[model samples]
Target chain A: MTETVSRCPVAHDQLPQPAPLPFVSEDPFHPPQRLGELRAEFPVSRLLYPGGEIGWLVTKYADVRALLADPVTFSSRNRQRANPIREMPEDFKEQPPKPGLFINEDPPDHGFYRKQLTGQFTVKRMKALEPRIEQIVADQLEYMAAKGPVADLVADFALPVPSLVICELLGVDYAERGSFQEWTATLLNLNSTAQQVRAAVDELDQFMLRLVKQKRAEPDDAMVSGLIEAQDGAERPLTDEEIAGIAFLLLIAGHETTANMLGLGTLTLLHHPEQLARLKADPSLVDTAVEELLRFNSIIRVGQLRVTTREVEIGGQLIPAGSSVVASNLAANRDPEKFDNPDELDITRGAVHHIAFGHGVHQCLGQQLARIEMRIGYRRLFERFPDLALAIPLADVKWRTDMAIYGLHELPVTW
Target chain B: MRVELERDRCCGAGMCVLYAPEVFDQDEEDGLVLLKIAEPPDSSLDAVRTAAGTCPNSVISIAG
Candidate 1:
C-alpha cells in the first residue's frame, strides 16, 4: 500500500497581506483625504498599480523635490520602466521613435531644446503678449455675455482664449482648432483606449508635420517658424520629425493646462466668496492670488512619473534599483511643512515656492505665460461679471477625474 | 541692498522680474535676468529678497 501522508490544509487567513495602497482620488478638485494619513504615516509607501505592479508613491514635499532635482538617480528618460500605468500599450515601452520634446528628455538634450525656447517665454515676452491676452479675455467675456445669463464657463471663455493665443504663437491655423482640440482631449484622457490614443497621436502628428513643412517653405513670425529658422541656422539642424514633436508638445500642453486653470480657478474663486470679494475689491492681488490658486488646486495631479536608475533611499525607505516612483504634486503643494494651513484658500498668501509647475530642471517652460494668462484672465473675468455664481448646485458640478490633468469637466456659471 | 544676478544661470522662469520689476529686468534676446538696480532703496528690499528667494535657479543673491 502506498504510504498516504495526511496533509492538513493551511489556513489562508494566516497569510500576511500587503498594506492597502491609497487609490488616486476620483475627485479632481480635492485630493483623497487618505493621502494626508499616508503622508503622515508612510511618506514613501508601496503603491500597487492596477495591473498588479508594485511601485513607490512619494507624498512628502522634501522627498518629491529631492526626487525631481536628482534626475540621474530618478530618471525621467526611462518613464516606460517606471510608469505604474499597466494599461500602457507595449509599443509605448520604448523611447518615442522621434527625438521627442525636451520635457521628456534628459540633461544635454533637454538643455539644448530648452535654451532655444527660453527667450520665447521671458517675462518681457509674456508681458508683450499681455495686451493680446487681455484682448482675448475681453472678447471671450463679450461672447459669454452675449450668450446669456447662464453658460458653460469652460466652453464659452476658458478654452478658447488660450487655444487662440497658442494658435497665434505657433502659426497653426486657428480655424482647425476644433479638430486638434478633440485630438488633444483624446490624447490627455487617461481612460482613452490604446487605439484611441494612437489614433489621436497619428492625427496630431500629421497636422504638425504639415504645419512644419509650411514653416520650412515660408518661415512666418510664429514660434514654429522661429524654431525652423533657428534650427536651419544651427550647426546641426533638427529633423522635420523633431520639429513636429516640439510643435505637438507646445500645442497640446500650451492650451490644455492653462485652459483648465482658468476654468477651475474661476470655479475655485466662486467657491470662496470672501476671497472673491477680496480679489474684486483689490485687483493688484491678482498676482499672488494666481500663485495661491495654483498651490491650492495643483491641476497636474501626479507629476512626471520617474524610475530609479540606481538603488536609492527616500523618506527613510530603501527603494531598489529600477523601481518606479510617482511624486504627488497635489500632496507636496498641500504639505503643512511647505505651506501654512495648506488646505485653506488665502488669495493674499504669496506662496511663490509652491511646486505647482514642478521643480528642478523640468520646471514648466510656459509658467510665466500661464501666470500672465491667469492674472489677466481672473482680473478681467471678475471685473466684467462681479456677481458671477454657479448656475447649478456645487454637488451637480461634473469633475474631470478621467484625465491625467485634474479639472472640472464642465463649470456652468451665471452672472 | 545690493542685488547681483548671474544672467547665464537664468533659465528665464521670470520670478525675479515678476516680483521685483523695479530691481530686475530681462534681456530682450535670450530673456536672461538683468539687474536694473544694484542698490535698490530701503522700500525695495522686501521685493528684492522675495525675488532672490523665489528664483528657481538660485542664481540671485544680495549683499550689503
Candidate 2:
C-alpha cells in the first residue's frame, strides 16, 4: 500500500477530495461490504463519519482479532472516550466514568476492576444462582405455555430472564421492572442523538442514585449491599461515585447484552427448524448449539474500543498512540481462514475458539453466568414446548437496524 | 479425550462442571477443572464439546 492508504480512514474525507467509500457500508455489522470495496480500491482508506468523528476501521479478521489480544500496544484507556471509528456521546464526553469500571480501563486499573467482579461470578457463586435461574426460565416458559397458541417469545420469555437475573444480582426491586427495563434498553443506544442519550443517562442516574441511598440505609445482602460492606472492610473502600459507576455498568451491561442474545438466538434457531429439531431430539446438543449460535451471529458486532498507547503495527498497518481501534468479534468469529467452514452453522462443531464473549485482560467478566442462563434457557424451552415455532414468516421479522448489536425487537411465535 | 486448561487465564467460574458433569470434574480448593479422562471419552464427546465450548476461559482442550 501507499502512504495515504496506511493513515486513518477518516482523514481522507476532507472537502473537495473526491473519493468513494468503497469499503464502507452505511449500515452497522455488515462492514464487510464496504471493506470489500476498500480492499479492492483503497485498502488503507480513511473514514470521517458524517457526524464529524473519524477513525480507522480494521477490515480484515487478521487485523481486528490480533489487535484485541495485544492490549499493551492497543491501549484500552484511549478507547474510554473515543472508539476511533464511532462518535462518543456528549454525556460520555462531558463526564468520564469513575476509574474502576472494568469496561473502561487499562492494565493495573483494569485488573483492579475485574478482580472485584471476578470474585462474584466464581463457580460457587454461579452454581448457587443456577437453581434460581432455572426456576426463572421454567416459570416464564410455563406462563407462556398456559397462555398458549401464540405469544411474543421475546417479551414473554427472553427479556425477563436477564432482567430478573440482573435485578437479583444487584438487589434491585423486581416490581419496578417497567422503568428498569426502559432504562436498560435506552442506555445501549448506538444511533440516538446527544440530547436523547443524555436524557436516558440522566434517568438511569436518578434510578441508581435512589437505589444507592436505599442500600446505605438498609445494608442488606446483595451485590450493591455487598460492595458497601466490602468497601468498609477494605483498606480503601470505593467512593460513593465509584460504586455508582460500577452498578451502572453492570446493571446495563449484564441485562441487555444477555437478553438480546436470548431473543435473537432463539429466533435464529426457530428459523433453522432442522437445527432446532436436532437439538430438541437430543437435549445434549443445547450447550454446543448455544456456542455456535453465539459465534454464528454474535449479538454484539464490535467489542469494546481500544486506544493506542504507543505506535503499533497490526495486520500490516501502523496505529499511532491516541488512535482508536476496535475488535470486530463478528468478523473474527466468521474468519474463513480460521474455521473449516466459517459461514455454515454447526451445533456439533466441537470446541470453536471464538471471541464472541471476547478475549484478553478485559474479556467478559459475566460470560460464565451468561452461558449457564443460555444453557438452561434452550433446554427447558425446547423440552417444554417441542412444537413452538415462529408465528411470522422469517423474512418479515423485524431486525433492529440502528444499534451495533443486531437483535430482534419482537419474536412472535406459536405452538 | 485429553482435557486442557489454560491455567494462566482460568478464573474458576465452574461453568464447565455445571453444564456438563460427565466431562468436567473440578478440584475442590482452587476450583480448576479436572478431566474424568486423560483424553475426552468418545462416548461423552458431545457433552464434553459443549462443556469446552461454553468455557469462558477457552481453556478446555479435548483430544482423543
Candidate 3:
C-alpha cells in the first residue's frame, strides 16, 4: 500500500493508511479538521491523489519549511500533473511546462525568468509604490462610501483595489477588468472542467498576445513595456509567446490572491471583534495585523505540491523517489509547535514566519506589493468607516469553496 | 558573527532584507542580495541567523 522505502521497518504499517487529501474545511477560517488531527498524531502520512497515486503529506510546521527550503530533493515540475485534490486533464499529463511558467521549472530556467522581474518587485521598489497604493485604497473606499449604506465589500472595495493596482502595474486597461476577472476566475476554479479551463486559457492568451504586441510597438512605464525594453539587452530574449505567458501569470496571480485576501480578511476581522477593536485602538497594528491575517487565513487551500526527486526522509517517514508530496501550508501555519494559540486570532502575533507566500526560490514574487496593499487597505478601511458592521450574520456569509484560492464569495457590510 | 554571501544564487525573494534590513539589502538593478555588513554586531546575530535560515536560495552563510 506504500511506495516509500522505509528506514523504520514499521513506517509503512504506521501510515494513516492512504486517506484522500483533505480539501474541505468544516470551518471556513481554519484548515480541514482532519489535517489538524493528522498534524498531531502523524506529521508525515500518506495521501491518495485524485489520479490514484499515493503521495506523502507533510503537515508539521518545521517539516513543511524544510521540504520547501530544499528544491533539489523535492522538485516542482509536476510532470505527471498529479494534483493532490483533483484529477488533471489528460492533455496536461507528461507535458513540459509552458515557457515563462517558471513556477514549475527548476534551476537555471527558473532563475533566468525570475531574475528578469525580481528587480521590479524588490522591497524598496514595492515600498516606493506605497503612496500610490494608498491612493488606490482611498479611492476605492470613497467609491464604496458613495455606493453604500449597504455594499458587497468583495465587489466594491476588496476586488477593485488589487484589480486596479495590478492592471495599472501591467499597463492593461482597467476598463477590461471584467473580462480578465472572469477568465481568471474560471481558470482558478477547482471545479472548472478541462474545456472551460482551455477556453479561459485561450482567451487570456489572445488578450496577452495583443497587449504584448501593443507594448512592443509603443513602450510604456509599466511592467510589460519594461519587459520588452529589457529584451533588447538580454542574451537570449524571451519570445512573444513567453512574454504573453508571463503577463498572463502575473495578471491572474496579482489580482486574485490579494483580492480574496482583502474580501476574506475584512470578514475575518468582523468575526473577531476583539481583534478588530485592538486594531482600531492602535492603527499602527496594521503591519502585524496583515501578517497575522495572512497566517490565520492561508488562502492557498490546495497547499504547495511538489514531487520527490529521490528517496528522502521527512518527519521520519521515508518517501520514495518520483512520489508526489504536498506541504499543507494551511496546516503548517496553524501548527501548535510554531504558533502560540495556533487557532486564535491575535493581530499582534507578528507572524512573519508563516509560509503564506510560500518559501524557497518560487516564494511569491509580489509579496511586498501584496503586503503594502493589505497594510493600506485594512488601515484606511477601518479608519474611514468607524462604525462598519456586517450586513449579514457570520454564519450566513458564503465562503468560496469552488476556487483553489479560499475566500469569500461576497462580504455584505454597511456603515 | 561573520556572514558570507553567494549573490548569484540569490533568488531575490527578499527574505534576508525582510529579516535583517540593517545588514542586507537588494541591489536596485537586479534585486540580488547585497550584504551591507560582513561582520555584524552580536546584537544583530538573531536577525541575521533567521535571514540566513529562511533565504530561499540558501546563498547566505554564517561563520563564527
Cα lDDT of model 1 by residue, A1-415, tens digit: 1122112121223322324344466554567787787777667777766556777788899888888877778877767553454367566766463465777777767767777787888888888898999999999999999997898999988899999999999999999999999999998787888789889989999999999999889889999998888875688788888889888888988999999999999999998899999999999999899999999999887566888888777766667888878888888888999889898999998898888988766778889999989999999999999899999999898877777777888888998
lDDT of 2 by residue, A38-140 (tens): 4434433344543455555554555655676676777776564654334666557657655455577766666666666666775557767999999899899
State which candidate has the highest lDDT. Answer: 3
How far out, in Å, is residue A160 in model 3? 0.8
**Model 2 Cα shift for residue A46 (angstroms):** 4.3
Candidate order by decreasing TM-score: 3, 1, 2
> For candidate 1 chain A, which ten residues in a row score worst on lDDT?
A1-10
For residue A295, give model 3's deviation from the true position in Å. Answer: 0.8
- Which residues of candidate 3, in runs, are more than 4 Å off? A1-10
| TM-score between candidate 2 and the true structure | 0.81
Q: List pairs with backbone clashes in candidate 3.
A: none
Per-residue error for B4 in candidate 3, Å, reads: 2.5
Better of 1 and 2 by TM-score: 1
List the candidates ranked by lDDT, beginning with the highest.
Answer: 3, 1, 2
lDDT of 2 at A373: 91
Candidate 1 overall lDDT versus native: 0.82
Q: What are the lDDT figures for the candidates, one per model?
A: 0.82, 0.69, 0.88
